[model samples]
Target: MCSLFRCSSASSLLLAFGMAVVTASPVVMSIPISAQNAVPTLLTSTSKTTFSDIKANYWARPFIQAIVERNIIDGFADGTFRPDRPVKRAEFAVMLQKAFEQKRVRQLNAGGFKDVPPNYWAASAIKEAYETGFMPGYPANLFLPKQQVGKFEAIAALANGLGLTATAPASNILNGSYTDAPIIPNYAADAVAAATQANLVVNYPNVKKLDPLEPLTRASAAALLYQALVWQERVEPLPSNLKTANYIVADVNQNNQTPNDVVTVTASDSSFSILSSLLKTAGLAVILQHPNNSMTIFAPTDEAFANLPKGTLEWLQQPENRETLIRVLTYHVVPRKRQVSELSEGKLKTFAGKAVNIQVNSLTHQTTVNNAKILQSNIQASNGIIHAINQVLIPPNINLSKK
Candidate 1:
């Protein structure tokens, strides 16, 4: 459906694709020109090579390391992986050259792109990408090589290049799985659906919110590329235990599970009625609905609120006490998605700028957030994760006195 390079005629010719080591999905890793420290010793995939910025608990470490081990991407000279950086179109093209090895599917006049001069550094990569049917130029033969590529563009390229097609209608597939499905560009619907079917899409924090138009980040690009490699049978999949594995999008239609945003997830479930009401009253529920946000909510159950001291809930709901209510409610939220397995005996900073002490009983395998026991854990939503607790967690230094 992509208008690039006559999708109608080219789609037929490019439909036949052969797998190889390096293909362009999105450049999940890159070596910046300033990375003079990118030596073979530092960039190799061995255990000794580590990026300073990628921590043990970082969500994308496994994918990034996997790509690094394959020599598909490299870290910076400064030892920092800079996983948050936006990947450019040219960089993605270069990565495509190194990451996939599919035989040419269709030949395009790569030289027609005026932007990529003959001596441009990425000229060959762009040409290869175009000729191989991984990435093609714009309507005007414009390959905006330096532009920041969005997730939709990246996945579309991968799906197009791999000759992936959606078995179901793109709209149905997208609407069923993603909260932000309406915003997905019409041109990318089929490719996005195909990529989703192939499990080539990896969304961290929330699995259901595609955030399709967001600029592709380095770590995210790596995850996408890794999945593509796995699809091609060119690389081993990530260990099942890794947090990164949880982010990979499975075959939703086959799985028969449609994901919803955090607020919707809470509102639909009768158990969260008390907590859901409080979030709405405190004007915090809308925040959770944002497709781009990745948060974790430690929701206290309705019974938990019932367990509160007599008149305690009533007093907190007073309009005058709204600020205190906001603080207490926000104490249950962390700005990032954290799975149950990721929680340990430590302090987790909350959205209210306070920290909650976590205690995990090793032998009993029971977890406690502050004084509240974790009644339920790892209730996933499109924009966040949710863990139900047995009691409300009041932040420190909040004045509960009614006005």
Candidate 2:
């Protein structure tokens, strides 16, 4: 009986043990009646629980409430969520145990960790998390239960536990996604990239700054865990603009409109100087710069234009060849804006009234249109999306075989 009451909180033990002593019987009580019944009844109830400190307007309040309603996490005895508080490793392990089912890859040993004794409060949870691949212990077989978890460690744990892997190079994913990309630890880059790709990363205050080394606050943990639940199809994604639903790439356009116009923004980039000049010369600038325009432009860099055979560009600029130039330029423009995720291996109709063959490599997440390769992708603009390609796409009528 004493062993059953050993790991519970002092207040809970006093209340439960006092009742048990008064009702002591000759026969020993069962594990459910003694240990399980002695714990809090929060899980047994079906109604939603609310915390005094967690207001509806709080950024992560919805996430906290969702997890709380599912009985995955609980508030403090004082009825506070303490959203800003750093979560301990033990607390995280317990949450992970309740949140996911055990899918052990190996046999469990008699003793799991050096520090987690059998009677410790989180011992079972720690073991379950370790066996299920949600959490791993430190070097020398140590489980630092009381240690504070970091943001990257939490992301890595979720990524690994869910068996997510990066489909693209870690450097490619991280380089343009976050401002503090260099600070991400080498070992965790792939896991973080997978997390970002899955939309499991939710940053508060600033979406682009992934502070990987910062302590994992309860609010952030709830948001990330909620995203994980969404990833597993256990719950629907939150319908809030405040939630970081996608990776925030650095805004290259100087105008920085909420939904920037693609042609105007593309012209702002120095690398697209030749394309911008060609757009103006082709009398196509007005079509793209229109406020309501929506299209995808495969803009080629200056280097791509320079690679053309000598005098090829000069001939295209001639007054007699204006119609031919328009066909070539319009071939690179698609009627609708298609982000990277929307692209697939197929043929898409261009503004020139002809189709361009698009090929996508699922493994590397690389995309190509015709003979040109998409160098930089998902450059968002209000009017459309601009994908920088290595070579200019030409229409079939505009033959450059001789050149």
TM-score of each: 0.54, 0.51
Error of 1 at 217 (Å): 1.1
What's model 1's overall lDDT?
Answer: 0.74
Best by TM-score: 1
C-alpha lDDT score of every prediction, in listed order: 0.74, 0.70
For residues 42-97, write the lDDT of model 2, one tens digit per residue.
33332456788888677677777777766656665556667888877887887787
lDDT of 1 by residue, 1-403 (tens): 1122122342231231111223333333464433212212334443334888999989988887777765667876568788898987878887788776655655667355888778777777788888777887888779887788999999999887765655456887888778898999998998898888768999878988889989998998889888877765457678888777889887667455444677877887788898889888877665557655567799998999898778889887888777778778878987555656457789987767689999987656678999999987766565667888999898887644432
